[model samples]
Target: MSARPEAADQSRGSAFRGEGLRKIYRTGETEVEALRGVDLDVAQGEMLVLLGPSGSGKSTLLNIVGGLDRPTEGRLFYRETELTGMKEDEMTRFRRQNVGFIFQFYNLIPSLTAEENVQLVTDIAADPMDAREALEMVGLGDRAHHYPAQLSGGEQQRVAVARAVAKRPGVLLCDEPTGALDSQTGIRVLETLVRANRELGTTVIIITHNVGIGAVADRVFHFLDGQIARIEKNDHPIQPVEITW
Candidate 1:
């Protein structure tokens, strides 16, 4: 997962800066702390991996960063813009304009073809690539006419990736992207994600429990008990094809 020589230059600017981030959820009498004082900086166009168990707060942090949720106490900056205090509509606009998301499930429309599914986003985006171009980026050009039910799991996930990136978002957030795929299929999905980051210069943050997948990231943030325990930088990252389960 070694980065290109130019990656360092691209990372000179901060894409996301978080300080003292904390999230507490209240379910009746129980109070659950999802994130506890998380402080981090994600460089522009950098590939970062968030590694942790189910309750370790990695997903919570990703959601907040992607503008899907807000922190209970903390400040988050996307480039120079502050996202911590944004209203719902502001957050929606921010996410629509700058962020892209890929989840464990494909979430594609069963009724639409792959290209049509991607078109759903491009139609609303300010600036977007052609639907076919987006599908081609994920190696699904030939499957553009295929419906979600006709595609394999890996293909479906790749379609999801294409749909997310069709808008040419600045940041790409993936949560357990390969959770439902086999190792071989997962590798393909990872390759698509890496291609997006490399070719499009999209800042990527992936949330996963797989230690092997972390090898592809420039930096890995390890989470434990709702907090980041440590951070590891990989001077030489391995490619997705080289990673093993």
Candidate 2:
């Protein structure tokens, strides 16, 4: 939430770059390779989608990129910061200020109203937009006083999106953000994400198995057997509302 002034040297290149990244989970003699030496680059202000089946390491890759998990081997650079080697405390600070996360579930407090749920983040965020403003951005201004239980699942998820973007984070990481919603609701949620990317210039990364969702991404990364099998770039992306996914 604390805004760090953009470094003079920061360019519109890779917002995140992982070189030979690997994650090994060892339990006694058996070792599980969650990531098999992944090398990928995500440009700033781009909406990128990562598609893969279960156990394909999509979530693992996202965790590593978001600084939520550290790679056992390799390097990760965020702009100029050495995120892969940073201490846990340093990583926590980095995540707090630069990253916004949206999970499959809305994760809103049961007792809080929509605005209150968002206000909780603003209170701790160093440079957050007002809760009302964030809610308005997501078309939830009229529901500010409504509780999560009173709103439909789609509305609740939109509120969740508002809370994540309120701090104006540098990166937005979404993991099956619409997994619990119907296709119609999912489309609306994706629209909000696309809007944020365009209007706020926030770098967005969505991890989902839904291949149809890739139509609106600037680039799509397909993973298989824990590695990137293909990378495709779309010169022009369809608007979120028009995308099939």
Candidate 3:
């Protein structure tokens, strides 16, 4: 059963809305406050970058937004759909319908060919581009028949990008997407993400430790002590190729 998105409240003009978001992890008597009452409104089609040190709550917030984890306290909405209030099954459907996530690792099956790996996503999506088309979009059309072991690290990551975008998701969530790649390869991956954002109008949110990566985003949020310390908006953002790290 493919998940189809409900009619969205496009008039809101926001991809995600958060109010008083907080996440606390407890083990026995010890407790860790990962987030502290965070509030935010991410505009539709905007590219946002989250930057912070470890334990600063960047990944925790990303996980909550992507439906991988629930916040201990707060409200989160996708357009008009209230995510925090949804049942687990509802959240699963919502995520499948509207969100695409990319992680630091490629996560491709070793035995599958590049096209086969991407096909796994298209098979379940309500509406998806052809696996070959997705591969071409990431400049891997010529290597679609190759297995993961036959591809280079950068090529493997590109295939992962193809798989995520093939679903035509409304939002793309990437956590340390380019952390495992070298500078040149990282730029290529960023370029592909930018192309997807522009072509598909997907709201892009990326979490990365590289401050240089922020140059490509429309806004950058710096997190500290479980809160957003600062937000910098770029009126004229540079391209990924122009970034120096």
Output the lDDT of residue 155, model 2.
Answer: 98
What TM-score do all the candidates reach, one by one?
0.95, 0.94, 0.95
In terms of TM-score, which candidate is stronger, 1 or 2?
1
Q: Which ten-residue region of model 1 has the weakest summed lDDT?
A: 1-10
| Candidate scoring better on TM-score of 2 and 3 | 3
> Per-residue lDDT of 111-143 in model 3, one digit per residue for the tens?
999999999989999999999999999999999
Q: Which sections of candidate 1 miss by over 4 Å?
A: 1-11
Q: Write the per-residue lDDT of candidate 2 for residues 1-245, one digit (tens) a residue.
A: 11122221135777887788888989999999988888877778989998888988889989988888999998998977889778889998898899999999999998999999999888888899999999999999999999999999999999999999999889999999988988889998999999899999899999987788899998888888888887777888887678665
Q: After superposition, how far is residue 75 of candidate 1 from its true place, in Å?
A: 0.5
Candidate with the larger lDDT of 1 and 2: 1
The digit string of per-residue lDDT tens for model 1 on 82-172 reads 9999999999999999999999999999999999999999998999999999999989999999999999999999999999999999999
User: What is the TM-score (0 to 1) of candidate 3?
Assistant: 0.95
What is residue 111's positional error in candidate 3, in angstroms? 0.8
